[model samples]
Target: MSTDAKTFLLTGGRAPCTLELARLLYHAGHRVIVAESLRHHLCRFSRAVARNVHVPPPRQDPDGFLSSLAEIVNQEKVNVLIPTCEEVFTLARGSGRFPDHCRVWVEPIERLTPLHNKWTFIQEAGELGLQTPMTWMAASHSKLTEILRNINGKFPIILKPVYSRFAAEVYLLRHPAQPCPALSVSPEKPWIVQEWIDGRQICTYSLAFEGKLIAHCAYRTTFTAGKGSSILFTPIEHPQLLKHVEEWMASKKYTGQFSFDWIETAEGKLYPIECNPRATSGIHCFGESDRLDQAFARPETASLILPQAGVQRMLSLAMWSYGLFSVRSFSQWRNWIKSLLAAQDVVFRWRDPLPFICQFLLLIYFWKQSRRHQISMLEASTYDIEWNGEY
Candidate 1:
C-alpha cells in the first residue's frame, strides 16, 4: 500500500452499494474497514475490508455505536468515516466526539436533519423554489384518513414513513375501499401521504464536497424487489434532472453522498418525490474511474464528472432467484441473460469469492430478523440498521 493512501471506516455493510464503495476505495490502495450491525453480512468476508467489527444498531443504541466508532477511529488512525445508509444521521449527530483528525463524511446536523425527513424536505424544497410533490404528514390512522378526505386528488395516493429507507412500507392506495395500513408507524414515527405523480422514475446518487458537486451518476431502476429495493441499474442521463440536483446540492451546500427519487412527467416537468440523504444503488453504476478516484482522494480539487461505462454491476444471483419469476416476456428474459453474462456480480470478485458466497447466508439472517421484527424481507434488511431520528 502507498504511504499516502488514506484509511476509511465504512458503515452499513448489509448494503451492496456500501460494499461496492469499499471495493472502489480498497482497490485504490486505501485501507477499508467496515462496521456492521449484523454479525454475518457479506462485508465480513470481503478482501477489500481490512477489518469488520460488529456494533450495536444505531437506532437502538446510538451512544454505544458512536463510542465504538470513536474508539476504532483513534486506535486505527482512520482518516475518514463514511456512512453508507441512514446511519449517516447518527454519525453526523455525534461527529464531534470523533478525533479532529478523523473526518466524518457527512453534512452538519443543521443541514442534514431537514433533508432526512420526507415532509420537511418537500416543504423546504418548495420554499427554495424547487418543484416537489404535494405532501402531507399523518402521525396516526385518523390523521391519515383526514388527509385523504381533504385532498381532492385522484387514485393511487403514495404513503410512506417520513423517515424510511429502501422504500419500505411504501403503499399505493388506488380505491376508496382499501384501508390505510399503518404497519410500523406511530406518533414517534409518522408517515407522509403525497399526491402520486405519473411519470418515469429516475434516481440519482451523488457526492459533493463543501457545496460543489464532485461526482454524480444517475440511473433508472428497471427491475425492483416489489416496490422496494432496486434489483437492476441501467446508466442514463437527463440534463434537466442533473441541473435540478446540482441546484439542490448547491443550495444546501451538501457535503456527502446523497440520493433523490424524481418523477419526470409526460410534459417534461420534474417533481422530486423524496430524498435519501445517503448512498443508493446508483453508486454501483460507477466503476473505478480516474475521475471518481480523484473525487474520493481529494474531492475539494476534483472537477465534477460522470461515471464511466463498463460492465454494469448487478446482483445477478438475486435477480435470477426471485426476480426471474416476475419476467413478463421472452425479450425481457433474454435481456436479463445478456446483462448477466456481460456484468460482474456486485459482491463477487475473483480475488475475494468468500464474500460472494457468504452473501447467501444473509438471507437466513434476514429471515430471522423478519420473523423477529414481523416485517417483510425488504423491511428487515434495513429496519434496525437505519436510524429514524424523526422524533
Candidate 2:
C-alpha cells in the first residue's frame, strides 16, 4: 500500500451496499476494515475487506459497540469510520468516543433523529418550504382510527411507523376493497398517515460534506422483495431530482449519507416522503470506474461526482426468490430478464467471489434468526442494529 493510503473502518458489513462501498474504498488505494455485529455477514469473506472485526450489536449494547469501535480506530488507525446502516444512530448518540485521529462519518444524534423518523422528516421538510406529502401523526390507536375515519372517503393514504425501514408494516389504505388492519399504536410508538399521491416513486442516495452534496444517484427499484425492500436497483438520474437533493442537503449542512424517497408527478414535481440518515442501495450504483470512489477516499475536498450512466446492481438471489414469481405480465417478465442480463450481481465479483459462495451460509444464519424470533427474514436481517428511539 502507498504511504498516502488511509484505513477506513465500516460498520454494517452485512448490507450489499456496504460491501460495495468496501470494494470501492479498497480499489481507491485505501485499506478497508469492517466492524460488524453479525458473524455471518456479506463482507466477512470479501477480498475487499482487509479485516473483519466482530463488534457488539449496537441496539443491544451501544456502549460496548462504541468501545469496540474506539479500540479499532485507535489500534488500526482508521482514518474514517462509516456506519452504513441504522447503527449510524448509535454511533451518533455516543459521539466523541473515537480517537482524535479517526473521522467518524456521522452527524450528531439530534440532527439525525428527526431525519430518521418518518413523521418528523416530512414535518421538518415542510417547515423548510419543501414539497412534502400531506402527513398526519397519530400517537395512539384511537388517534389513528380517528384520522382514518376522517380520511375514510378521501384519497388513499399510507400508514406507517414514525420510525421504520424497508417499508416494514407500511399499509396502503386504498379504498373499500382493502379493510383497515388493526394496529397497536401508542404515544410511545406513534404512526403516520399521509395522503398517497399517484406518481412515480423516485429514491435518491447521497453523501454530503459540510452541507454540500459530494456523491449522489437517483434510482428506482424495478423489483422489490415485497412492497418495501428493493432487490434490483437501476439508475434514473434527473436534473430536477439532483437539484432537490442539493437544496435539501445545503440547508442541513449535513456531513453523512442522506437517502430520500420522493413521489414525482407527471409534471416533474417531487413530494418528499421520507429520509434515511444512512447508506442505501444507491451506493451500489457508484463504481470505481466513475472515480466517484475518490469522494469517500478524500471527502473533504473532492469535487461532486455521480454514478456514471448505464449502471445497475442487483441481488440475483433476491430477484430469483422474490422477483421472478411476482411477474404476471409478459412485459414485466421481459423487463426483468433484460435487467437481469444487463446488471451485475452485487455480491459476485470476479476478483472477490468468496462472498458469493459464503452468502448461502449467511442466508442460513438469517433463516435461523427469523425462525428463532418468529420474525420475517427482512426484520431478522436488521433486528440486531435497528434503533427506534430505544435510547
Backbone clash total, candidate 2: 1
Candidate 2 regions off by >4 Å? 176-178
Q: What is candidate 2's lDDT per residue for 164-280, written digit by digit as tens?
A: 888989998888457778887998789999888888888889999998899899997578887777788878768988988888889889898999888888887888888889999
lDDT of each candidate versus the true structure: 0.82, 0.87
For all the candidates, what are their Cα RMSDs to the real structure? 2.0, 1.3
lDDT of 1 by residue, 265-319 (tens): 8998888877887888888888866435568668778898787765476787778
Task: Judge candidate 2 at residue 253 and give its lDDT.
Answer: 90
Give each model's clash number.
Answer: 0, 1
> lDDT for model 2, on a 0 to 1 scale?
0.87
